[model samples]
Target: MNRSVPMNKAEDISRTWLEDFAQLLTKTENVEEGVTKTFLPDGWLRDLLIFTWDNRSLNGLRKIACYLQENLPRSVISNIELDHHSELAPKYLPLNDTLKCVCSGFKFSTTVANGHGFFRLVEEGPGCWKAATVFIMADSLKGHEELGYELGVYGGHTLSWTDVQAERRKSVEVDPYVLIIGGGQTGLNIGARFRQMKIPALIIEQNNRIGDNWRKRYPTLTLHTPRSYSPMLYQPFPKNWPLYSPRDKIADWLEQYASSQDLTAWTNARAEPIPVYDSKAKRWSVTIIHDGTSIELHPVHIVVATGMLGIPRVPSPTDQNIFKGVVFHASKYEGGKLFSGKRAIIVGAGNTSADICQDLVFHGASSVTMIQRSSTCIVASSTTRDDLLRGWPEGGSVDIADLKAAAIPFLYLKKVLTEHAEEAIAKEKELHDMLRKGGLNVSFGTGGSGCFPLVFEKAGNYWLDVGCAELIGSGRVKVKHGVEIAKFIEDSVIFTDGTSLKADLVVFATGYHTMHDGLKTLFGAEIMDQTGPIWGVDEEGEARGCYRPSGHPGLWFGAGDFYYSRFYSKQLALIIKAIQIGLV
Candidate 1:
């Protein structure tokens, strides 16, 4: 088995190009304490290099020169290989060609180091080439072998497990540098990132146990995305894990992750009253109630990782109190078994609504109806796994996939997805027609961007169909499109369309209010207003009030899906670290 053979001509060229780039990068030198310089000329880099660290575009030449000088070690690059497929195609003109490559190799950085690089090369002349974009990320200087012993009891004087637990239990008395609110995926991820940066962070979860957020969801609920796209930092799910994990499985995984990652999380804890920020001290004084005991904590930074929809938004109908039935928000709906042999009306046509409607039908509900107020972007699970996640490496390291996903600019990715949406809708015209015929309203989402952008931009306008569409299309689950509940009548609901439907349970899957609303109770209305909206893309195409500075000092928001938290947690950690070190 000859391992050195190139898979193709493009791979050979890519490998050779990356080797040359690594050689030049290793020769670079630091010019100052935090800055560096390289001999690479101006034309050797792209105008805008996509940085995965914060998903920000940087001046390619300057950032690359600085990064290489600061991070690359002076050692010979070895075992350079094309990690993924690459292609050579014409660029700028017919005479100029571009070579896109992603490669990996090893270098000596205190020890044997691994690095992954994504490169774009352009033919400057017939026989001359220049780098259009060069993005490289290397492993930490410290190797696993060197740090592995620190994780276990190595000496007789080592701290006992009970003592360690006690220290965490008493963390409320000690002023931590950062306090994260929420024990969900976002908070856990931020805690992990802060731990890796050697920053003291305490996570306060209102639930009795970690991962209860997912555990409390409906039994039929499962992750819509594949396992490959939902890994925490440094720890990926085992290959034996389900492709689409169920609610309880994910809940258990999160609990194990928090423990395995050594993140300090105070469960069965609630932030009492509201946190008051002291301007003179530049710290937040927050009171927590745990197990009937009140504890105080003063932290320099407060991160609200309670998710984008931190507070449930249950709309009040004109005559709501008169309804003679069980009424609850989607968040409170445990399962459809309780509604068995009963008529149910689920308000809202989002993913949760769809899932609940299907669950109701499955649980032997006498009648189930979904009241759709607007069009929903519906994409098949297969399409999502096969097309949206097409180029993503299967069974590869999630960190690598995340970096690759981040390499593409958001707007550009949106455009690409828009085109994909158009093609997909065209291919599934019959499915769309069937759903429409079944009284369901569907769209390709805003600006044809489909479900991906809708998730970030609106958070509730789309749903990735996982057999629910089939149920709706087959008329197993009923849908009432283009209308709202005019009022709730006794033992029946009157719609805006002058129609009426009998119901025993009314579930409002009307989504939730922005995280800013949740902050209002914690911080005064003035401070909450200053924070602006939480989720949605900004002018720079990044998440508006997340992983970046909030107008209020020392306050940050960390919210999103698993992959999102995994990527942006580091960014939030870096921002806090910078503030702590006076680098901001």
Candidate 2:
């Protein structure tokens, strides 16, 4: 058997595999037998095809076999067809350093919905292939498809567009199906999803503007991810747009996105009274205060789309009243320009602290010092961007790109990456050398998996260096590692090692508390206590307490950066839509 011969027959090979697999599924007398014949010995399945009615990522044939026993045979999926698009075609893919497999894609349908599937095949012997990983995702529900193009008001309409808009608004004002709190990217994106699905959702934002979440950030702040990596729902940034958009520009885009998407949102609004969920009716009766008027609304679902972090966490040192310099948490940090000609100290060694240190030096601060409580994982921005988004192709169809990304289960990716961790750490020899020379302790993260896992485990434990390392290496910025802040004197910040650093201003660049505490404040201990863990990976490797369930009924949590907010919020919209139509 010639090794290169399969390249010519890749299509036929994949087609045959699909035909046989589809028949194998229908003839499944037993779920265990089905898994044995169709999947690899160590197979993986990322099932979101509504058979689970929830998202699940299973590793190994044993786990997949057990899950199939619970959710299959009743699914009745059919209409399997090959998808030969450039991105989803059968080709040899280097899944990781240790494994290379032939990846192919297909489309399928269930009784009430449509879905896409991708399988990575491993050649067991000559003319033999078995699926190493299988991913199934529901694309849309039947009879509830969204109109892709705009439905303009033509000549034969009785009501003007404004009147029609008002009528549609009035209908939801009476009773909305979903109530979204906090109009950040997550809230805004979710609202768009509901509108397109014809599900009534109302967003209440405490801020005065739709994009105030971005506007209120530090003046020097900018999104490091490229524009293409984090597109808005139904809108991509202009081609000439900056790769790294400034804060003010992003704020404007978000404000325009809400208007163009026809999202029903109320700025300067908040849930006045704690929502009371009526189990009998399966609705939450809550009052919202909008600019001075209080309105009552009963919504079947309440989505808390607050920003990733809840409350700003500041350290409380003993005898802090003696300090005179300006002190604030990173959340309240205005801008470093105000500290020009002054000495500045930034506490904590996460991304926030690194940015502040850079900002302080750039703003002509006489001296800038960083205090590190623990070692931090740092990677080059270019390397991190490419590695995290390798599944996505530049300037291609995002739908296909996103699905390809979704096919890799986070847990499976983490395990493989960890096994290949030394390879990642090896490529950063120069960056680590510069950091060590700058007197800052560095790490490739726990288990030497580098910084990827820390993104979810402790979102603030790493920084993607964008010129910060050079500044620290050149001595433009100073670093103090492995020490905790002890106290503050009138002229200097005292450290646990009895050393002190004098500064005119100090900022604690420490991270914030998770949404659990803030939700507890909004919904009370009863609702909070019942909720599952928020902002971390679960046993199945999916993010916990969000885009799925939070334990309490009629409550959901939506959050993450632009990419995550889009991908996961879309999934949340599907789950909610399914629940609304009695599918789950």
Candidate 3:
């Protein structure tokens, strides 16, 4: 029997990594140890420290080694060794105390890409022994800078730090370090798309690799929506290919796209930005700490393309710690290679939950059960496939916006009419329905909610909400109402109905809580003013979800809401271009 490594329950594994490797900074000398450390000069000492990690997977160790050797100056990274026997163990160690004494400013680096790489002190005398580890220190401003480096959307640009305060004149700063936070489809697309536009962005992912999440998906997962309209910029999904690409197929395409574009440099760089608003300069001072050194950037504008799927939420509340078989968010799900013969339960009613169930079953899960709190409009892949396979003509390509624009004239004409046509029509419908019930009239007119969705007098109330109602009636899926999960009990979930389901694996395909907790802290009261009732129904009253924070300026969401439509990305790209040219 194979035993797994005892892992922390938290999704963000980097937090634990920082704690474990904090010891390595003990031997290294700080560039300047004052209350402020953000102004440290950028040089060989700063550059010599090559920090890396395996953000993609446990296998990212090799990729980090290759990245360091390829990108950094020669002789900086040496004596690389891999030990397979030491699985889940720290591979590198400090050299000796003697060498440490000679090297006063000796430094160590940690890999943010994956939690594997560590710094070492090499001493070659009297049987060299490993010495103390160094800890990288970050003061307030410095901490913010480091955060910005890892999480900042904009790439680094060259602008004198002090000169910004000295002069308020708008001057363009040339791009230097381009940081892209997300490693998802949009993030990858932005990097690829912008690189073609001649701005090379250094993409940083919290995960291990470019497409690890996609590759680990269940076998049955396929693109439910139209694929022809959905694709990375410039690179179209090949024609004659299947209308619905499997999960792995999309993953493979992303990896290939990156490889082809020579974006391997972005593989292990997990940068977080610490943004400081310079009141004097009227610009944000963003600092990014990579490995162990700070690289401050003054960007004219920042693009936050962090995708939606980062944060996972549970719908109906259940204390996860109570039962403790094996629980994880969809983001952390690797393949079910180890789950053969085990029963699994997937919760939630979205595409993610659907994929999870399909994947678990394919992985040899003994039994897989899905629990949904509400009915979803379950349109099959057939409609989506047909749409993609049969391309629409130019006239048909007019989007929802175009249709709405055309409806403006009709609305004006309706307003001008003094005959009370709408009220008359309502009266006629009521009278006709009353007569029809009495067997006096037998005319079937397609009366609806008077609008697209709200009307349904002629077709009957059943057809009004037929989509959702039928899905519940369909025996293909299990339906539950007033779902109240009591607790998780010993490889099973107990419901408020006093019913318990045996489960080997219970997945919360639950919805996602807003991933803007970090942003909330950063923006403070401004965030509340910007988001404007976060969980409320009137989402679009502001800027399409979370975009209104800056009055529709500065804030750029890559995958704000995935269901918005394919044109949303194209619109985003166009906005970015306009911003670049000062059009927006």
Candidate 4:
């Protein structure tokens, strides 16, 4: 069908809904041209209602009339297509002397002399009028208020209020406890590396056990990317760390790594909205309520390592009351033990689906059907590596030029050359040779390559290949020709193709959504509006990820959106180092 046909319909719907929304917004006490509407807290309430229905429809009109007495914007009314709907008239109630009226939960004094701020409303009619409250402050009082506000009028006049709190600089010993929120490689590495840095860290897992997550993954699961590039924060996997390690081994290794480092991680320590407060002692107060006991602890910094894959959102169950059977998110799967005597249907096309499919077959399942939304760009792990290392049974090195000559087609030679230079100058011959064999070329010099200086070249393509071949070749994990799980019926699941398949279990391995949830509040609306893309660099002309429109000192963020180096741990190390040296 024509996709553009829905475009006009959607816009018309948005215009109608927003018009009603604006009328509802007029109930607030704080009034100005559009100030009341702008202050309506940014949340699902605003997001969902803004573009939901067309004001022209009868149902839409009823919804608008019922929810009208709230704070909404004036632009909404101008855009709304109100033909001859007499019910779409303005509604208002004046402040009476006998009793004070609480419009939109804002209390106004019955006597005019008692009220601090008075507002006006922009109404269309008796039933359609939208009250716009303009503040009536005496000239003298306005001057006094101005003393505490800084004004900047560029795009428009914006008053930034200065915090009136006392700047209490306290002297206290540096707190040492660290709370880690994820169990992935980043979490393990960050904690382990912190240990090396002489900092104590506590890892909290949302799951039941430490490595049980990786243990229950699909059997065909193997690391798609190479190991050398994706080194944990502290140590590299075993010397013979499979170009791709299996699912169970990755988890087992993490557990062992924690044990080896003596990390303070509590399994099942799912930090569910633990209250974190600033203390009078000038440290952070973390109230961890575990096992019915409230543990008050202070940590210098909270390192959130909940990587990209923690939140798995499934398609909304079309009919919540109906469909039964097993519906588990990828994060909760133990194995196919329950799928022993039933046909299983898996959703999503990523690595998790491949792993789950293989596991189901081995557990004596009747049949396994995989459903995917898009064709994945799958490749062998061996292809994404330092070709010579695998080529030579007993690993040795090749000259940079030799590698460039051999892997002529691959355009990554310039990167390899830069790494070679760093290795050669560091006087680390073994590392130098490793760079050479890993398809890199370099010359010893202080003056290096271009903007992407050859120096961090090897670091760029950190994990190219590892265990992808084993997963794709594994017979049990079949690549099905379908996408989008439309709905789940009682005994079968429907696909986007209008076809249904009998199923027992549905696993959604459809990767993680970008984490912008925390940013909406932490940075506020102005900053969020200026934010480019949440996870990566936006191709259009916008600010880079995590970069402030104008840099704010001491107020810095990492991990959320910025793409830095793997030795980014080293970068963090350097930052901490500078802080220690007072050179920051």
Candidate 5:
């Protein structure tokens, strides 16, 4: 018997062994041929790879297999050793006298490359072992470079690069294969994926500039999630960027992403009427108002990336004509300075409600009160970063985290999250006690599924307490829980409990309508009803109406935060591409 190898030596041996395995995979007729049954045993990778590929359809898998075969190294690059610092490292099983290793690395060539590989191996007997599973990245073998000779010096060329760009910009009437509505994070992400797949796509934004959606938010707003959890596809934020990026910084990043990725977005353009889909031709004829001029486009597909919460849902309070105070939705609340020395009443108790209340307090509002229509799931921001997002730590690969997340079915994920939430709540008992004692309404969320599930299912039921919970606990921000607005009087709002409070400004943080409701004007009630509800877990445990087909032909919905968009954009692009190529 031999003693377990040192960590460094174990890593080296694993790397060399995996490289050999990679070479063996290249020589096989098919990448999946004889790899799993012969080398790897039944395990996580086996289940995930086979399930994903099989579910994607054999035709789709064949296309992917061809791509892998074309770019996988016929032999290992001798000069360049595999990246050993990958998250997967060999572990010593002393009790079993075995070494288990799971590893991944990338191999690049001049024109094409193998992007990533996931491998699992265990010591079968002494010096000999077999791979349990191996998953490799498929690369489309194509060169990505601009064709030119000193701008205008080439043969048959008369225009400079700038002139060419201007000409291209002028020709906006041309037909595109895919038309994406909303140039926000989701839109830009899918657009970038389409660009990589060589699929022609155009994004139409209602705002004059890209990222105005983020820019229009409150002045003190910053991303609640970490930078690693919220990155655009292909391009991540610079290393020096704040962990929680400010709103404007993110806005600027979106603008730069769209430009750098060369995504064709028509800003200040909006779809005028409901798009008419031709079932027979599998195309969408959309009329968009661009700079006050209507342009008709017949695109093969129309992706509604207008976000999960597209329309601000402002409840029309009765007796509105009597109230004299300023009234607006949370979306219209840009800053607190405007409400200085004024009593503010924010309706609803969610993340936005909490943030707005904190902002009003900071900006010297005379009195701020949060009306809690329902209990909110409250977790500390630190808890979210350390526990909920432990999978996506700083410096970890976002793609890897995404892949790992996708591997787990949402049903099982919900169970896992529920258990995690229970443990998390117990761990932070002091915080929960403080919140409860301070008269703040808190819950562990629906079925104790915590933040992620709540976001996916309800979209506005949870709040990751940054500082507002403390403010509420300390009475800096008053909490009026378990109540509903009865009606508005001349200068105050009366609660259902017969309590009246004077308010100079009323902010409704009641949240937005569903994506389906938001599309009623453009898609019409009939078409929208056919499309089904926007966000929620479907029977398949996937996000309803996203990445998968909507009920209507040639219509799709892409909505989620940065991670969700980045992770699922490939599936959306592949589906679109498959349809275009007649595979699906």
Candidate 6:
């Protein structure tokens, strides 16, 4: 094989390889063997509702073979053509500036829908360039492709935008095909996707405003992720947007997002405490209450995007009945200035606790103490943005960034990030040493992944250091580790280790139950038990019970960060559309 030309021009090599690969896929007998030869020994294949109406990641020969053997006969992937668009042209993209991959995009079609994909290949040896990862994402179903933005009128001044909007609102309000229960980023993104796919969806927000979920949090709160990494559907922040947006700024963006998308949303509306599902009709009977009036509606699908957890898990102290100072869950505690000139004791050392501690120090709290029941995973905000958000470059298209991030399977990414986390700690040894010297317990993340995979795991147990770590390291805030709260008194709080701290305000930053557990009241214990696990990863490291079939007809769950919501919302929409149309 001639290697000099291939080495000199990665694009030419990729073009030739893709042509052969497309031809290889035509013959059934050669397809499996071709995949084995083309991909690395531990290559990854991430499928977002292309092969089937589900999100899946395949690694190694066994999973790939089994998946293809089961679904390939039915999926009948065909019309594999390489894309020649300038933006998607074959090029050498670097991974962490260490490994080079010749990447190219392609267009294809499955039995159910049409799709596009990107393949990243690396030079394995002298003449072998093997695929490191291949990502296939569904673009549209055969008949349910997202409609273009076209004026309703062919010849102008006759159509009223207001009337059209009202008609759409009434149609969905009367009998929505999908009902989303929260108006936060997750719910908003899901509703936006449904809107684009022409699905009748109504978003019920319990708060008085669409963005209140973010606005109600403590002031001075800012997002830890970079601006390029945090964006709503279809809209990128202006070039002048801040690197780290404040909470209120984000809240305003969410409020604007719903309006811009023209989504049907009801603020200050709550679905009934419990919904009754009619199995025969395949619909859920729910009532939305606004102010005092109630309206009955029957939606075929119900998406519980309220949160990862709805109920707060505040601890009950034994002696709280005897004497008490001001005590409340962290959610209820508005701001640190409210507790000015008063001693504060906060239980838990996760993100919320860290934020509260930092807020109190900035404000005039007489003293602040944090009770860390267990060690915490800590990484600087800047380090996290650089380490986890490398794919999301400044002034780049978010679509490409999302595709690149989703290319690697979760389990493989977890292993890679763990190594990066270890390197991060070693590099920031001075900061960690000071934090330990000041008595704050720290864990580098679950399995030492630097808390990158925790979003797919427990969702808590980590803090992205903003300014609180510096304050803690400098002894501005006191830390009490390895002790649980024994009881609370009128003037002081006692610990199980027989230590007591004088306190005027106590805040429980303790986390809540798992998302599935939070649904017991709304879904009832029986149905909740039957549903699949909501947030954590399953054996294959794919997110369970979210953006996929929830183990029950007409029920779905939407959860995760902005990045998670942005990409998976489409996955959720595609599967739901397939189900509704009887195409799956």
lDDT of 4 by residue, 1-584 (tens): 11121222423433333354444444333333333332222101111112211101111222233333242332132222322222112212333233111112111121111111222232233222232221111111111111222233432534322211111001111234455656666666666555555545566665666776667665556665455444454455667878656777887887887776555666665544433335353345655545545555576555555543335666775652466767877766777887798877776654466567667777887777666554432222344344323432222222211221221111222334454544334543433344334322323322322212211221121222133223334434444564577777888777777877777777766655554445444344554454444333322111133212213222222342011223233334333333333433
TM-scores for every predicted model: 0.80, 0.96, 0.50, 0.48, 0.79, 0.95
Candidate 6 residue 530 C-alpha distance from true site, Å: 2.0
Q: Report the lDDT tens digits of candidate 3 across residue range 1-584.
A: 11122233111222233332232122133312310111112101111112321001111223322333344332222222221222212332122222221111112223211111322222223323221222121111111111111222222545554454224212212233244566667677666555444343555555556776576655555665455545554456676656556778888787887766544234444444346555454344565554455556554444455654435565444665767577766655666666778777666555566566555655677766556564332233443345333432222333322211221222222222323434434544543343223222122222211221111111111111212222233322233444656787766778878888776676676655554554454345553355433221131111233222223234445553222323233334333443454433
Task: Order the numbered candidates by TM-score, best leading.
Answer: 2, 6, 1, 5, 3, 4
Estimate candidate 4's alpha-carbon lDDT, on a 0 to 1 scale: 0.42
Evaluated at residue 72, the lDDT of candidate 5 is 44
Model 6 earns a TM-score of 0.95
Candidate 2 stretches with Cα past 4 Å from truth are 1-6, 95-99, 154-158
Q: Model 2 misses residue 489 by how many Å?
A: 1.3
- Predicted candidate 5 versus true structure: per-residue lDDT over 1-584, tens digit per residue: 55466566666656666666555444536565534322533322312111222222112233334434553444332222354445544533332334444344433332232234445455556665555444443322224221212334433676566676555445534978889999999999999898777678889999989989899998888888888888899897899999898999999999999998777899999997778888888788889899999889999988989898878888876897799999999998889988899999999989899899999999999999999877888888887777536778778888777764554455555765775665767876777787787787788876788777788878878888889877887888888888877889999998889998999999999998888888898989888888877888765456788877788888889998898889777767766765676645
- Which model, 3 or 4, shows the larger lDDT? 4
lDDT of 6 by residue, 30-110 (tens): 567877777788888788887667788889866675666666655577888777776567777666655667888888887
- Best-matching candidate per TM-score: 2
- Model 4 regions more than 4 Å off: 1-174, 198-202, 205-213, 216-220, 225-243, 262-283, 290-292, 362-364, 385-483, 518-534, 538-566
Which pairs clash (backbone N, Cα, C closer than 3 Å) in model 5? 40-131, 40-132, 41-132, 274-522
**After best superposition, candidate 4 residue 578: deviation in angstroms?**
2.3
lDDT of each: 0.71, 0.83, 0.40, 0.42, 0.72, 0.83
For candidate 1, lDDT tens digit of each residue in 434-527? 7897899889877777778887888888887876777778887788988888888789989989999998999999988778887788777978
Count of steric clashes across candidates, in order: 1, 0, 48, 35, 4, 0
Model 2, residue pairs in steric clash: none
